[model samples]
Target: MRLLWPSLAVVLLLYPALAEEHNYQLAGPAPGSIRFKWIHGSICAATNRDPRVQAVMYNEDTYILRENIAIHYDAPFTYLLMGNKGALLVDTGATEEAEYYPLRATVDAILKRWGDLRGKTDLPLTVVLTSPEYLSENQGYRQFVNRPNTTLVPLDLAKMKAFYGLTDSWPNGTGRIDLGGRIITVIPTPGAHKDGVTFYDSYNGFLLTGHLLFPGRVMISNDADYVASLTRLKEFSAQHPVKWVLGSQIDMKFLPGVEYMRLIRYKPDEHLLQLEPTALQEALATATRMLGKPEVAILADFTMRNRVGPDERPGRRPANLPRIPQLPNLR
Candidate 1:
């Protein structure tokens, strides 16, 4: 699933028009288009000379790492939150190519750089996935599952509930995890996506929503649960000043209404990385209105599609669906 240079050119040329047609706000060519250097607030293309994982500093204590689109079309973004005691890595991305997806190496480099800057050393890293499905499906997880001073927390509802002291509250409970000087609230959100959870970074005022509300298709497995989750999310957001709503994937293009191709690894005109709280409010409103209505509803930014019957199992893809063709390796 590698993208060659020539195919990359084709995608760059055609994406703008496609994005415009769908009303996505086009943000020209990605950063480093000419010289391929890391640029803040731009999707920097990856090269052999540079590591596949590109880390962009969101703030002094937080870094957002995105996998090169050429390596995996999904190109999911991971969050690294630094604290006085240790660091927390949100998700391990969607790449299985060990050579291309060096998540652990990237983390080590970032930690070293951060340590040098702050005079801190040997900070433990705790890796937690939005869902356990990522462990078996994403090869990126392999890089950190056995590393030293790293703890890979499982995405078990019961275990997490107990650890966070939310056993009494169960699925709808909120638990607090103190990472040294930083404190984050973990809210259990399990319906929109199985084992789905949201991490609220109080210091940064950022809501890290994993698969609950991204810019693409928000698949609702259970309508009742989805409604409850969104209601809780909205109420929680109202309590805090949410700076931005960050999600794992960006399916919307830079243009307003355009969506990226599901299988394309590279997104030249991707939407802005962070979504405002208003977007979440709108989504919550839409979901609230459709509480007892049909299972499927379409919104401007995302589609509310429901999965029912026997196919609701996690990691199960419908049979006979056409597979997206992978571009051959150009290098």
Candidate 2:
């Protein structure tokens, strides 16, 4: 696998923002048409030119929005929705005006495509943000404010209260959203990203995973709760059998410096979908590797890199740790 030197170097320096926050914008074109740029690399290239953005249309109706937004680091904002009921949007693109150009237009195009639902007069539409990144950074959401009954659903209730305006509820775990007649089930998976989550469309076994399960990447996880959240999906899939593995971002070649601009869809049953089981096993193993190993230093290093102004990343440590003696055993 090719490694992103800048990303890895930033990681080595332990910059929290490099992993958590993205700083980039759209490069070319207008709404309905867009190309993203790697702001970091653009400045470093000898040509001092923007990196060519690759756009991959996952399908006619299903779009990986990140395909249109600048990729700052490893992950990109991804959205997935089928009609209104089974709408499973992954990540909200960036939080800036430049990045919002295509993101807002793409969302409008999606809503317009699903205009058949006659009940739009009432029961307004709810755009669910699987995690905070989808909502916090993406200022484009402001465009949806005019829509009737438009509400933003987040994962953390306290954060929802602090930032989001429309809806004040944070998804605790598994919850159901009645999108008119459409159904969206939110499954909280908090490991890879803080308060990160995924949504399963009960209507069609379509699993819209954000940064949780990016194709060809070792789900960079550390926090135990997030790992536990991912484990829950393994158990759920064992019972429910996810038919489709729809990801936000994917690079088929796994080559370095080759950015992916498309969503990779895998039809398990159709293609003998056994890869998920293997992938799930690997994800868990990675999480287990962190167990008993103190991650405070990693967290501290990440914070130092971000130049976190004042507020520190907040969350309680998992209670289940092996108790070690205060001093060496006297034998």
Candidate 3:
């Protein structure tokens, strides 16, 4: 880190605006276009030809990469943010085989090109997971192991808390990472997954919530914990302006209160991945109202249901578990 400081200082002298807060005009090309059409998987896997990983340059300093749905059903979205001194990677996608997935190769290519373009080389890379509990989201982590100048944060909750400086006020206060001048704030949002977290990019006002607040089925194990996490998110959003709520997956369809069948490779009428900032407030309200409801609350943007557990069915449940209805077909 210290080795890159001199170069960063030189760049700062040339660009004085970055010395203060650097406000980036978030999107690239237009309001909707993001490099290439998102390759929502094919109906049949045998003929699928989409790249194992699809990347879109959100901006010069930011890139959004989604694993091809054909390669993995989850096809989680991984984010790469470039800073003057270093770079930050959010989550690694599912697939593990290099011949099939090649996540690290793809990322290396992107970084090399970006470094050449910016005349910066060997910028330290830091990789962090949204939630270590999700296996598919972190499966591709081996691609980064022993890689030069990279740090893959461990999956242990204790280690993560210590690394992010949230040991004292975990799941309550915030932690941060300074990627050079850009500081991304980290908030604990554990409900859908106990180790869940949401990251806020200070430059673009993008709130990257992994599974907690996506536009899909948000399965909750503990309703009170989920509600409390949502409250924390709501309070944080009140203080910080959020531009986009980006989730890892988009299972919900265009139809309100409906999601695509689980493990379906193809989704033609899928809902948009990016949700408006108002979504946070809306989600909080809906979750609060469904705190003790017996039905699976389905909203236009998202559906709230209980995770698959012994007491997850439609019948009577313990006071702690949220009332959830029966499961549906397909998804």
Candidate 4:
């Protein structure tokens, strides 16, 4: 009876890890759900007083945050991942002013709450970027300056290469950060911008694509470079099971190849922010089609813009939109 009780206790302690391992083997990783609704902008920007940031807790340790469209037009998404040893903050955001956008205060509150729960007073934080060249994706890097126990990562390719210890084989080689038990693989993906990167989380199977594969007009800095990056992602996803491909923005509507126009304060029926592995496959297939000719490829989930920045006037429609009759209000 004495031996039986000790054995039972051991089994009880090991059960969760063993079950998680089994689940991972069966599917990608333990799948999580979106717990919060996204904050699309309003028609009247001045009247919109929603919180500057919308936060969703994917799980106890993983959080997804987005700047309100009213706060910044880009409304880029950021992530917070906590592990036993430390935590990583992905993308500072599009805003720098605390008065207008309170990302720093919001992050600090989350950190304090997590520290209290984990019973660790001195938790370290590492700040990183998704797309270094995009101002909207990295304007908030300076917000973490002089923050206690926080490391602000560099936004340039050279410094980032050295910081991630990828200087040996940069832009082609992979880098990683061992957040205690949860390892994050940083894959260099510099097509959308010169220093963009995609993050893969081992713990939850999240593939953070940054601006590379968002549900919108995906502008390419270099088609060849973009193709190489997409190929890298395809090879990587084949080896690792990815539960979700979270992107930086949501510009397309639920309808196929239909996107919200630029500078529109209110976005009606914005597309789901989360995408599946199939979307990545489709993106690669489409991007490959635009190798030499740089024409726009209007795909169901995304539109591939061959150039960077605003390539067209705000409301100018693309070449080949599906011919669906408009609703009463739309017409």
Displacement of the residue 165 alpha carbon in candidate 4, Å: 1.2
- Model 4, position 114, has a per-residue lDDT of 74
User: Candidate 2 — what's its lDDT?
Assistant: 0.45
Q: Could you list the CA RMSD of all candidates, in the order they appear?
A: 15.5, 19.1, 9.0, 6.5
Per-model CA lDDT versus the true structure: 0.68, 0.45, 0.79, 0.81
Candidate 3 CA-lDDT value = 0.79
Deviation from truth (RMSD, Å), model 3? 9.0
lDDT of 2 by residue, 66-147 (tens): 4222333323445554443334444555444534245545655565544433222232445655556544334445555565
TM-score of 4: 0.86
- Lowest lDDT 10-residue stretch of candidate 3: 24-33
> What are the runs in model 4 whose C-alpha is more than 4 Å off?
1-28, 307-309, 312-331
lDDT of 1 by residue, 170-200 (tens): 5777887667757778887777666777888
What TM-score goes with each of the models?
A: 0.74, 0.54, 0.83, 0.86
How far does residue 188 in candidate 3 sit from its true spot (Å)?
A: 0.7
Candidate 2: lDDT of 133?
A: 52
Best by lDDT: 4
Tens-place lDDT digits, model 4, residues 40-132: 888888899888888778877788988988878778899998877788999878889878888888888887787766665667899999877
Give candidate 1 misplaced runs (Cα > 4 Å). 1-51, 134-139, 292-296, 308-331
Cα deviation in Å at residue 192, candidate 2? 2.5
Candidate rank order under TM-score: 4, 3, 1, 2
